[model samples]
Target: MLYKTKGIALSYIRYRESSIIVRVYTEAFGLQSYIVNGVRSAKNKTNRIALFQPLTLLDMVVYHRDDRDLHRLSEVKTPYPFQHIPFEVAKSSLALFVTELLSRTLKEEVGNPHLFRFLLTSIVYLEEATEQYENFHLAFLLQLASYLGFGPENAQEFEDQLRERSLPFLADDAMTDALNTFMSQPIGTPVRLTRAQRADLLDALVAYYRIHFDNLGDVKSLAVLREVLG
Candidate 1:
């Protein structure tokens, strides 16, 4: 059967001399792999390979077979053109980290419209915002935790008292209020998070993901992401 859907490029692996296998998360199909033939060949190489870049949002028509492990793409185009995500270093790094995390964590063939929408919105927000890249990544991790069913229940888990007191950056009442709101509605970005708070939250999120996802081994890109954000 042939199907049309919007997909987010997750990761790709080189196959043979001129072929590649790309994993993508789609709105209609949760996770799917497509094999592109002659991607490195002289004919249409640039256009064919450009659609598979990390975190690229694509509208595609694919030929799916019930018994086949790999599918084929008949047509592809960018569904939402990014303004700054690919060009900006911080935003690009964040996108890469998030895509890697999702590519590993989401392991189902079933459709998830809500998760798809959340990711699309997040990518848009990351592209537009200038300040608060760390906050954005932290918020994304927290929000993802809820979807993955391991979000924290209290703010204390995401705080370091010694640093909090020493810096006097985040007010006690403000942190408390934000945590309360976050617990109530485990979606969307928090107002703001301090540098210490961001680190703590990232740790909490990674721990939460590990608790839920048995196969989420040591994330190789995590160190690179930390370096980018730090």
Candidate 2:
């Protein structure tokens, strides 16, 4: 059946001679995979493949099937085209990290409108933000955990939960303060932290996520994100 939805492009892999299979997180259907054909053909001039860029916000009409694991896209376009994420190094690196994180964590094949709205809002905010976005990914990770049902309310809870599982994590005063800020404040709020501090906090956050999700292996974009943010 055909459905209209807003989707966030997560990732894609080349399928055949001229097609690709893209994974998208949609507002109406949670997460889905669609096989798009002819996007890479030499005769194609419209560059339709650009719609699959990581974290791109798309408006789509799709053919969904309850019994099938893969589906098809009848139409797709970027309604809120990013203005800075693709052009700036720091923002682009953050986008990459966010995409990888979402692809790993979001696995449900059901509608999650609230989670989808949060993701959409965060993506647009990151794109338009020119400064004070260094903490964006950290904030994003913490908030996303809440939607996944494993979020801690504060630094103490974070440490306590890890300790309960025999996972050693010691958050110093600075890291504690940063965690509290990220957990309590909005994404646009600024929290001052040096490059090294931010990197350490990110490692801690990833460890926290690992406790809840067994397969969230090494974030491939972490090194690049750290270098770009530095």
Candidate 3:
């Protein structure tokens, strides 16, 4: 079956030095992998490799066959260019972190239009925000928790329960309040947090994930993201 869908590029691995197996999350097809041939060669002219960039938004035509593990692509192109995240060090690291997280976590091959829209919007938010982006990954993760079935929307109550449970990684009162604001506020809301506060809140969010999910394992990009954002 041929399907035209909006896709977010997740990751790709080189094959035979010229081709790549690219994983993309599509609006109409959930997570899918397509084998893109000969794009990495020096003599290539079609510029197919550009569409495989991490977190790039693309309009794609893919051949989907349930019997096959790898699919083929007939068309792929960027709908628009990112304004800044692709160039900024801190933002790019965060993008890589979340992209890896999604690649590891989103395993099913089923369509979800709402989840697809949220992912697209979040990517745009990362690109368009001019300031206060130091906490973008933390905030994004918390919002993602909601979609994953355990959002801390009732911030104060959730914090109180965590504290009562003696969760050692729980944030202090002021940071907890800031997190509450983060949970309650919409994306693009101005947020200010000290480096230490950001780290604390990020730890709290990771702890939240550890409790709710299985195998979210180490976010290796985190150390680099903290060093650069700080």
Best by TM-score: 2
lDDT of 1 by residue, 1-43 (tens): 8899999998899999888999999899889999988887777
Against the reference, the lDDT scores of all candidates come to 0.74, 0.91, 0.81
Please count the clashing residue pairs in each candidate, in the order shown: 0, 0, 0
Measured with C-alpha atoms, the lDDT of residue 13 in candidate 2 is: 100
- Model 3 Cα displacement at 184 (Å)? 2.4
TM-score for each of the candidates = 0.83, 0.96, 0.91
lDDT by residue (39-108, candidate 2, tens digit) is 9999999999999999999999999999999999999999887789988988999999999999999999
All candidates: CA RMSD (Å): 4.9, 1.3, 2.0
Give a tens-digit lDDT track for model 3, residues 113-197: 9889989998998888888777778778877777767787666766764676677655566776677777777766767778887
Candidate with more favorable, higher lDDT: 1 or 3: 3
Evaluation by TM-score, superior candidate among 2 and 3: 2
lDDT measured at residue 9 in model 1 versus the true structure, 0 to 100: 90
lDDT of 3 at 183: 76
Candidate 1 structure lDDT: 0.74
In candidate 3, how many clashes are counted?
0
